[model samples]
Target chain A: MTQVIVTVMPKQGVLDPQGQAVAGALGQLGFDGVGEVRIGKRIELSIAGDDPAGQARAMCEQLLANALIEDYTVEVGA
Target chain B: MSTTVAVLRFPGTLDHDSAVRAVEGLGATAVEAWHADAALPAGTDAVLLPGGFSYGDHLRCGAIASRAPIMGAVRRHAEAGGRVVGICNGFQVLCEAGLLPGALRRNSTLSFVCRQMELEVADDETPWTPGLETGAVISIPIKNNEGAWYGDAGTARVVLRYRDNLLGSTDAVAGVANAAGNVMGLMPHPEEACDALLGSTDGQIVLAGLIA
Candidate 1:
C-alpha cells in the first residue's frame, strides 16, 4: 500500500518562543552561529494513493497546521 | 437531576478507563463520544476531555484534537455555559478549543511533571467545582509533559490564582473555570483519585460536583 506523510512546523513569521528560548540558552553556553530554531512534527499514514494525499493535505491545512501559526508539507512514502 | 456525561475519544487517547470511572463514580450515565461524530447524544449534561496524547498533540498540545468534529460541539456546548471539562492533555484541548483562554506551554522547567498536588477551587459558581470550597485543598495526581500554564499578565491573573493550601502554597489555580462559569480545564486527575485505590478518594467529591 502507498503511504502518505505530512510534516508540520511552526510557520515563518510565527513566534516560536520555545525554539527562541533554546537558541538563547545555546548562545549563553558559548555556541555561535545558531540563528534560528523551530519545532515541528512528522506524521506518516498508510493510505491508498495520490488522491488520499490530497485529502490528507487538506486535513493538514485545515486542521493540522494552523496556517496562522504553522506550515506543512505532504509527501508520499513507500 | 440525574445527569448524563460523555467522554470524548479521538485518534490517540490513553487512560480511557479512569475517566469513565470518574464519570460513573460521580453518578452520571456514561457514554463515549467519538471525535469523528458531531452531535452529542441528547441530554449529555457534561463532557469530559480525558487526558492522553490525543491526536499525538500535533501542532501544539490539544491543537489537533480541538479540530475534531466533536470539538465544534464542545465549543458550542461551552458557549451555552454547558458543563465541559479537560484534564491534563484534555486541559490543553479545552484551551485550543477556545472554551477557555490561555495555553499549556511546555513545562517551564522543561520536564514532564507528575506529582500529587493540592488544588483550591477558585470559585464555587461552576457546577464542576461546587463540592470544593473556594479555597479547599484537594490532592490529585498530576502527570503531563506540557502542563505549564501560561498567558499574559492580565490574562494569567484572571485565569489563575495561587491558592493557600494546608499541604503547600499552591497557586489559587489548581484548576480554572471558563468565562461562562460552566466549562473547566485543569491539570490534575480527579478520575485517577476518585478511588482510594489510586490515591485519595477526595476526587469523588470533585467529580460528583460536576453532575450536581
Candidate 2:
C-alpha cells in the first residue's frame, strides 16, 4: 500500500495578491532575503489500500485543484 | 402548493434575504437559516447559500465556512437530488464544499468587480434553469472580490462552456452544475435583477424555474 500527500496552490506567474501582501508585510519585519512567498493548501491522506498514491494524485487533478490558476504536487510513500 | 425553502446566511453572507424573497416571490415558503445551526427547520425543501464573506474572505472564499454544520444537511439533501443554488459568495461556498467543481479566485484583473454581465444559458436541463432555452442570453449582476473561474482547458470546454462559436466569457464559465444536475453555483446575482427597477428582470425566470 502506497500512501500519498498533496499540496495545491496558485501558479507563480498567475499573480497571487494575497501572497504578495504577506510578502510585503514580511519585508517590514526586516526579512530582506525573502524574495517571494505564495500560499497554498497542504493535504495529507492516509490510505490503507493498494495504489493509494495513484488515487490521491487523481483526486488532486480531477477535483482537488484547478490546474489553470493552481498547481499541485503529490508525495508517495517510501 | 406550499414549498418550504431555507436560505443559509453564513456570517459575512449579505444577500440571504434577497434569495429568500426570490423564493417566496416564486410561491415557496422561505426562512433564514444560520451557518452554525446543524439542523434545518422542518418542511425545508431546497437550500440557497446566499452571498457574502462567511469568514471575512479568510483562508479563502468559502474555505472556513465549508466546515459549517448545516452544510452536512445540505450535502445530504444534494445526495438525494434536492435543489440547491449558490449565488456569488454562495457559489464560493458550494465549491469549497466540493458540491461544485473548480474554485473562484480574484478576477484575472485583480479588482473587486461590480457590474452587470450577460450569461448564455449553457444548460436547460437543470431544475434551477428550466426557463432558459439552452442558448439564451440572460443579464445579471455580478459583484465580488474573488470571482475568477479556473480549471484546465479540457474541463473548460465540455463541463463549463455553453457551446462552441461563442465568446462572452471571463473563463468560459459564469456558472457550473454538479454531475447530478440538482445543485448549481453561479457567480451572478440573479436576485438583484429580478425587479424591473434593477434594469433587468431576466433572473426571475431562472429563479422561478426552480420551483419543485
Candidate 3:
C-alpha cells in the first residue's frame, strides 16, 4: 500500500479571494510577517498500486485540480 | 424543424426550472437531461447548462460536475457544430469541461454579487446575440460567488462587457463564444431575465438567438 498526497493551488496572478480573506483575518488577530498568503487544498489517497505516482498524476489532471487556474503537485510514498 | 434544447441537470443544480421555462417560452421544446445519463435526448438541437452549485461545488465550482457522463454527449454535440449555452455556474462547468476557454475564479471582492447589471454586446454575431446590436447594453441579473471570468486575452473574443466592471473580469468580459462561434458561456442569468415580471425581457433577445 502507498499513500499519495496531492496539493492544489490557484496559479500565480489569479485572484484568490478566500486566501486574501483568511490573510486579512490573520492580520486582525495580530499575526505578523504573513506576506501575500495563498491558500490551497491537500488531498491524500491510500492505494494498493503498481505505480501510484502515475495514478495520482492522472487523478490530479483529470479530476482533482483544474489545470486552467490551478497547479497541482503529487507525491507518492510507501 | 422545431428546435429542442436539452437542459442538463446535475445534483444541486438550482436553476433548471427557470432555464426550462425560458427555453419553452421561446417556443422551443426544453428537456431535462440527467447528469449521470450518457446521452442527451435525441434531436437535441442545442444544450443549455443552467446555473447552480453542482456537486455542492466540491473540489471546485463545476469541477466534479464537469466529469458527468452526459458531457461526452455535449462534446460530440459541439463537435458536430451544435449550439451550446452555459449560464452562471454552467459557465464554470463549460470551462472545466474544456468546451470553452478560461476558468471562472472567485470574485475579486470576495463576496457573492447578486444584482441587475448592464452588459455591452461586444460581439453581436454569436449564436446567442444576433438581435443585439454591437455595443448595445442589455440589463440582466448576475449572481455568483466564483463568477470572475479569466482567459488568455488573445484567445477570448469578448462577447459582452459589464457597464460597471463587476467581478474584475479581464477586459470586462461578461461572456464569450468559442472560436467556432457555436458554444458560449457567460456569467449572467439570461433565463431569469426572460420575463417582463423579472423587470426585464432583455434576456429574451439572447435566448431567442439560440433557436433562430
Better of 1 and 2 by DockQ: 1
lDDT of 3 by residue, B56-90 (tens): 99988899999999999999999999989999989
**Residue lDDT tens for model 2, A13-75:** 766767877888899999999888888888877776777877887777655666646888988
The numbered model that scores best in DockQ is 3
Q: What CAPRI class is candidate 3?
A: high
The TM-score measured for candidate 2 stands at 0.74
Worst 10 residues of 3 chain A by lDDT: A47-56
* Residue A36 in candidate 3, Cα distance off native in Å: 1.4
Winner on DockQ between 2 and 3 is 3
TM-score ranking, best first: 3, 2, 1
Cα DockQ of the candidate 2 complex:
0.15
The regions of model 1 sitting more than 4 angstroms off are: A1-78, B153-173
Candidate 2 lDDT over residue span B52-103, tens digit each: 8888977568877777888998999889888888888888888888888877
Q: How far is candidate 2 from the true structure (C-alpha RMSD, Å)?
A: 6.8
**A-chain TM-score in candidate 2?**
0.85
Best by the lDDT measure: 3
Residue pairs that clash (backbone atoms under 3 angstroms), model 2: none
